[model samples]
Target chain A: MILTVTLNAALDVTYRVARLHQGASTRVLSVAERAGGKGINVSRVLHTLGVDTTVTGLVGGLTGRSLRQDLALAALPEALVTIGQESRRTVAVFDEAAGETSMLLEPGAQVTGDEWRAFTARYAGLLPSAKAVVLSGSLPPGVPVDAYASLLRLARGCGVPAVLDTEGEPLLAALPARPALIKPNADELVATTGLTDPLAAIEQLRARGARTVVASLGAEGLVAVTPEGRWRARPPHRVAGNPTGAGDAAVAALAVGLANGAPWQSVLARAVALSAASVAAPLAGSYDAVLYQRLRDQVAVGPFTQL
Target chain B: MILTVTLNAALDVTYRVARLHQGASTRVLSVAERAGGKGINVSRVLHTLGVDTTVTGLVGGLTGRSLRQDLALAALPEALVTIGQESRRTVAVFDEAAGETSMLLEPGAQVTGDEWRAFTARYAGLLPSAKAVVLSGSLPPGVPVDAYASLLRLARGCGVPAVLDTEGEPLLAALPARPALIKPNADELVATTGLTDPLAAIEQLRARGARTVVASLGAEGLVAVTPEGRWRARPPHRVAGNPTGAGDAAVAALAVGLANGAPWQSVLARAVALSAASVAAPLAGSYDAVLYQRLRDQVAVGPFTQL
Candidate 1:
């Protein structure tokens, strides 16, 4: 089973309103809450696809309890470590009329040194039974900057392939550990490598020690630089829907491929299909099954070439 | 001890951000959360003033748990009834740059018949030991429209004076139950009475069955019509700050007056002083102690006569 780690797990709250008026009171028509974070979203997509996965992370306080309950409700297996501070929450306000969304992300609670030690111990325990481990999302305050690097080292020691999905310093710090794969979206790729060109960014990431670099270009689709060769996979068509979790959906496909040792072409094709299907669906970690099936075969996977 | 009932209690979450950009992700600089509701605010004010008070309300789910934990941390006594559904949350985003606040109110969980029954049973159990009770805020969906009326009747049956602070249909329904005092702001008074004049609105409210009507006219202070006589109390000068919980502070003072059987002039003076002092404070359920003490004597109180 693939183990997913979301160090900065969140109770994602979505408010549906007719419209948002700044500096005024808006009565939310509806509220939808779920356990959310990059790794958790990846696990959700994997679980739905009938892939074996376990969600492991740090959670605490009342918000943490809600997140755990939601994970249970979703039937996602979890071995979350409890901490002292309350977990953070991300509020997304969706304007029905404007068809737009705004978000407020709380800076998550500081994980103390002791808590980090405890989490690593738990992660080590879980690694023994894991085929592959995916470390995703930002490091909460007080956590070491190279948190993923440490986790990558632990996974490597256990002979488990690791997939790292994060951006900025944490992403940069984790690269020297040589994770099996890394998935960075277009913006994240540019930010991480300081390169505007996707192929160049992927190359830079691979040189830094990532065995495989899969960069997702929002509407453009997946570009992968791997040991096998460089390849680009484009979706059959652009799907109109929320694109928030499309990249995570792609990560789920890549992790599944990593666990099964699938070829680069098939893996990129599956990732692009899943990413597009997720866009067709309204919520993150969810995909349109019919669209995914139809697009899986239609996804164009070809050799990558810089124009 | 005064009893404050908040059927629609909330975990008030405040996000302090440099600025809010619509349809974009804003990273909150800080987050502050507290248990809140109109009645809870009244209880908080009363508690802060060293008054003997108990907070009674309907709270449920994880949000409720957080609310209760906050109340406990504040050292406010409570006998909250639990329900199956989660309590609501009100998100207030304070834009430091613009120096303004915007809010998103979750349409609290629907109270089932069983939950309402459970709440009334709890209220009934608490009323026998209470000197006075204050019912405040809006009713959640599925709760009977005359919920406050029922509570008022129970308070009256237990020989406890109740100060009802609500608007629209619930306020109109509870008026016939003859609460000891009803505090309505200028807009609520006008809406309730369908009259443009504050004095006329106060008269109409008393005519309906409220023993007294204390109408808050914002910076203009308060105009109270009671059995003793009509009186007006104005603050020494306008103190600019947040006015969110100003009325609740007045209700706190009114509930104290109802418990002590204070004269109308003294009660109105105290209420107006506390209201203005609350306006000078940043958060709801809090007051500027120095300002409150200063304003207590400086407030101009006299027999009110309509021009």
Candidate 2:
């Protein structure tokens, strides 16, 4: 079973409007709420793809309660550590006509040291039964920047492969632990390595002790480097829609491929196909199963070189 | 004691940001949550100003619970009626340097007929003990525009003075009930009467059976036309900062004055001063008592006539 860790969870609220007017009130045509966090999103995609996943995170207050209730309603497996502060909420105002998405994110509840300790202990307890652990999302307020490093250490201690999906300080700090895999988007790779080239950035991450590195390039697809080989995967065509959670869907596919013992090339191909299929779905981290199967065989994989 | 009704209540969340760039992520400098709705704001200001006030409104779900907890912490008198749906939340992004505020308002929880009947009955039950009832804010979804009119009918049935503070169809519909008082902002008056002239709009409202009409004109102060007399109260200077809830503060002051048996002129003077003081305060509906008192005596009151 896969374990996903989300330090800062949120109630994701999406509002559909004809257009977003700056400094003017706009009526929402539709509103939808769901439990969210980077790891939660990844786990949701994995579950929808028929993979078993467990989500663990810090949550508190009324917003936290709502998040948990929503997850239950969705029948998602989760282990939430209750804290003192309420979970944050993220508002995405989607302008349908313009196809622009505006986001307002709240810097969720602050987690105290004791709360962090409790969550770490809980995570350690669950690590033995988990085949792989995916650490994702931003660190909540009051959590030390090196918090992910501790979790990485714990995963190593339990002999569990861990996938680190985050950026900036936490991602930088966790690198010394030599996580099994690290997924950084183009911007995150640039921020971490000061290298605009995806190949150099992936090499920089590998030099920092990442066993494998995957760099997700929006429409261009993904470039991955593993101990076995370096591979590139791309979709046949770009699907038009919101690309918000496509990376998460890619991460979910990568986790599934690794669990199913797929090779580097096969994994990259499956990940690219799943990510593309997600863009075709209306909701984030969800895709049509039939479309996913159809596209999985069409995904092209080739050896990655300097270009 | 004064009773204030908020048919559509909200948990107002304000985020202080350096700047808001649409479609890009923003880091909030500070976050604040307050119980909000037109009537609730008035009640908060009234309590802060040492007026005996009771706030009655529809509340539900976790957001509603948070609102109640906040009110309890503030030691405000409240009788929040529980509904099936959760209360809505409003996000206000304040840019300090530019002195601009962007707002995202959510359509509040829908009120069922049974819920409306329950609240109306509850309001009627409290009428015998209430000195005056202030029906404020917009109607929630599922609640007809005539909801306020029904409340006004109940107030008239009990011989209780009802002050209506609303806009659009609800305001227009409640006017024929001949409420003891109605406070409409300059924009609301324009929309309701299609008249740019404040005096002409006041005359139109009075002609429609409203006994007293008070038109709030932000920096220009307030204009009131009553059966007894007509008065225009203007402050000596324009108060700085946000004028978001100044109108609610004015309504609160007017309710206090009427409950304390103040004359029409004193009500106008106190309302104007209180509104100016509210603009000076950080949170909406809050005012400096000393500043309000100092400005009260300096307010210019004169007969309002169309020139």
Candidate 3:
């Protein structure tokens, strides 16, 4: 079973309104809430892909309770550490007429020193039984910036793939720990390495100690520089829809493939297909299966070339 | 203790962000949540005024749990009925840059038939201990349009002042039940009675069996045509601020006044002063104590005019 860690889990509340009239009250046409975080999104895709996965992170207060309840529907087992502060909530307001969404994301509650230590201990305890570990999302306040690096160390000690999906200081700090796979989107890659060239950035990341670097190029699809083989994958056609969860879908496919020891081309194909399918789907962590089945074989995978 | 019933209560979540940009993700700088509903707002104001108040209605699931925790901080005792559905959540996005707010209100979860009966039974049980009972806010789904009428009947049967604070059909249905006082804003009065003149609209309400009619006129304060006498009251000077909770402050003062059998002039003066004080404060259910004290004596409370 794969283990996913989402330190800043949220109760993702989405509201559909007739129109978004700024500075005025709008009667919501409908509201849908679910448990969400980068890791949870990956876990959702993994579960749908038929991989056994468990989610563990910090869960606290009533928001945490609601999140856990939301997760119950997904049938996820949690070994989450309880904290004194409540977990945060994320609001997405969808305007039906305009077909737009404005998101408000809370920074999340501060984690105490004890809570961070408790999470580390729990992470270590859960590491041994997992085929892979995926550390995702931003670090909450008071957490050491090197938190994911510590988790990567535990995963390495247990001899399984440790996937890191985060940005900024956390990504910079975790690189030296040499996580098995680090999926940084084009923007995150530029922000971290200060280089516009994705291939050059991947080499820089490897030199800094990441075992493998997979860069998500948005509509252009994915480029990877792994130890075994360098590859590039692309969808047959661009799907015009939300790109929010596309990266998480790719991460899920890659994590599942790494755990199962799939061929590099097959893993890249699956990730590209799933990412495109997720983009066509209406909400995050959801994909169009019929579209996935059709696109899975259509993704073009070839040897990577210098950009 | 004053008893306030919030049939359709909410967890009012307020987020402060730098600027609200449509169709983009915003990082919320701060978040504050509180128990909210028209009746609960009244209860909050009464509690702040050092009046003992008990808050009751329907509360369930994790949102309810969070609301109850928030109420605990206010030292409120609950006689709330249990329900299977989670309570509603209201999001208020405050744009610090533009100094404006956009509110998203969910219609609230559907209340089961059993939950309605259970709430009425619980509301009745608390009626005996309350000096006065306030039935406020809109009816949630699955509740009858005449819910407040039933609550007014219960309060009448118990011989306590039943204050009705709502609009539309709920207010229309409760008129014949003769709640001790019904507070409707000028627009609500116009909508319900179809009369343009406040005095004529109030007379139509009295004709329909209402005992007293207190119409809130926003910056003009309030006008009451009661059995004791008729009075119009306004603050010494208009306080320019948020008017969100001004009506609720008036309701709280009126609830206290009716319970104590205060003279008409005394009740009008208190409400006008508190309402203005509340408007001057940053949040609803909170008032400027110094403003309230000074305005209490300075408010002009006298006979109503034809204007």
Candidate 4:
């Protein structure tokens, strides 16, 4: 089973409007609520794909209770550590007329020292049962920048493969701990390695001790480097929709492939197909099973050499 | 006792920030939550002034639960009609640097037919005990625009004075019901009467069967036209602070004066003083007792000719 961690979880509230005008009152057509955080997204996608996954994170107060309730309604397995302060809420205003999206993110609840220690102990206890652990999303207030690195070390101590999918300082700090896989989008790769070229950034990531590096190039598809070989995979047809959780879907596919001992080339192709299918689906982190299977067969996987 | 009704109540969340920039993420320095709605604001100010007040409104789900809990925490007496859907939440972002406020209002939960019947029955049951009733705030979704007019008719049937504080079509519809008093800010007064001049607007409102019309002109104080007399009351000093709930504070003072048997002129002066004191307080609809007393003595009341 895959274990996912989200240090700063949030209750995401989405409002559908005909259009959004700044500094003007709007009447929403509909509203939806869900649990949100990178790891939660990854676990949700994996669960949709019939993969066994458990999500662990810090949650608190009423908002946190709402988050957990939503996850339960979705039938997603989760183990959230409770805290004193309420979890933050993220508002996504979707404008159907303009085909535009605006976001207002609340800074999540602050985590206390005792809460952090409790999460660490719980994660450690679950590491033995977990085949692979994925650490994702932002560090809440009061958490150190090196928190991810510490978690990476803990996973390694238990001989579990760790997949790290975060950006900025947390990603940079965890790279030296040699996680099995690190997936960074183009912009995040550039920010972390200070390299404009994606291939060069992948090389830099590998040099920093990541066993394997996957770079998602949005519409262009996936570029990955593994110990056995390097491969580039792309979908035969582009399926356009909201691309909100496509990357999380890709990470879920990759973890599923690695745990099943799939070859690097096949794993890269599966990840690309799953991601494209996610964009084609109406909801985030969800894909049509038939479309995913058909796209997986049509995905083009070829050898690639770093310049 | 004064009864305040908020058909579409909300949990008002305010975030204080150094500055606000469009299309950029902002971190709030401080956060505050309060039970809010036009009628709720009026009740809060009345309670602060040691007036006997009971708040009645529709509240539902978790957000509604939070609103009720907060009111109890504030030591305010309330009689809430519970509904099925959750109450709404309003976000107010305060940019201290620019001294500007931006608001994002949520369309509150839909009110069902049965819910409306229950609420009206509950409201009617409480009317005989109230000396005056206040109907304020916007109508929630699924509620008719003429809701306030219906409630006003109920108040008249009970022989209790009713104060209407609202805007747009709701206020326009309520005028024909001949409420005891209607307090409309300068903009709302102009909108309802289609007259730019304050005196003319008040005349239009009075002609529509309203027994009394009180027009609030922010820093200029208040103008009132009653059966007894027409008068203007001005604050002795300008207090620099938030003016968000000053109008509601003025309406609360007006209710208190009428309940205490104060003359029309004294009621107008007390309204101005209470509003100014609210401006000096940190929270909206809250007045410093000491400041209010001092300002009450200094309020200038005089006869004024219609412009």
Greater-lDDT candidate between 3 and 4: 3
Worst 10 residues of 2 chain B by lDDT: B95-104
What ordering of candidates by lDDT runs from best to worst? 1, 3, 2, 4
lDDT of 3 by residue, B1-307 (tens): 8999999999998999999989999999999999888888898899999999999988778888888988898887777777898889888999999999999998787998888998999888888889998888899999999898888888889998988898888888888888889899999889988888878988888888789888899989899989887888888898999999999999999999989988989988999999999998988888999999999999898896674
For candidate 4, what is the TM-score? 0.92
DockQ of every candidate structure: 0.93, 0.59, 0.87, 0.37
TM-score of model 1 (CA atoms): 0.98
The DockQ score of candidate 1 comes to 0.93
TM-score on B-chain, cand. 4: 0.96
Lowest-sum lDDT 10-residue window in model 3 chain A = A69-78
Q: What's the distance in Å from true for residue A189, model 1?
A: 1.9
lDDT of model 1, residue A196: 91
Q: Model 2: clashing residue pairs?
A: none
- In model 3, the runs with Cα more than 4 Å from the true position are none
Q: Model 1 off-target regions past 4 Å?
A: none
lDDT of 2 at B177: 84
Weakest 10 consecutive residues of candidate 4 chain A by summed lDDT: A20-29
Give the clashing residue pairs of candidate 3, or none: none
Residues A250-284 of candidate 2: C-alpha lDDT, one tens digit per residue: 88887776666778888888888888888888887
lDDT of 3 by residue, A1-307 (tens): 9999999999898999999889999998898988999988998888888889999999788788878887888887778888999899888999989988999998788999999999999999898899999999899898999998888888899897888999889998998889989999999999999998888888999999888888999989899899998999999999988888999999999999889889989999999999999999987887888999999999999996675
lDDT of residue B253 for candidate 4: 82
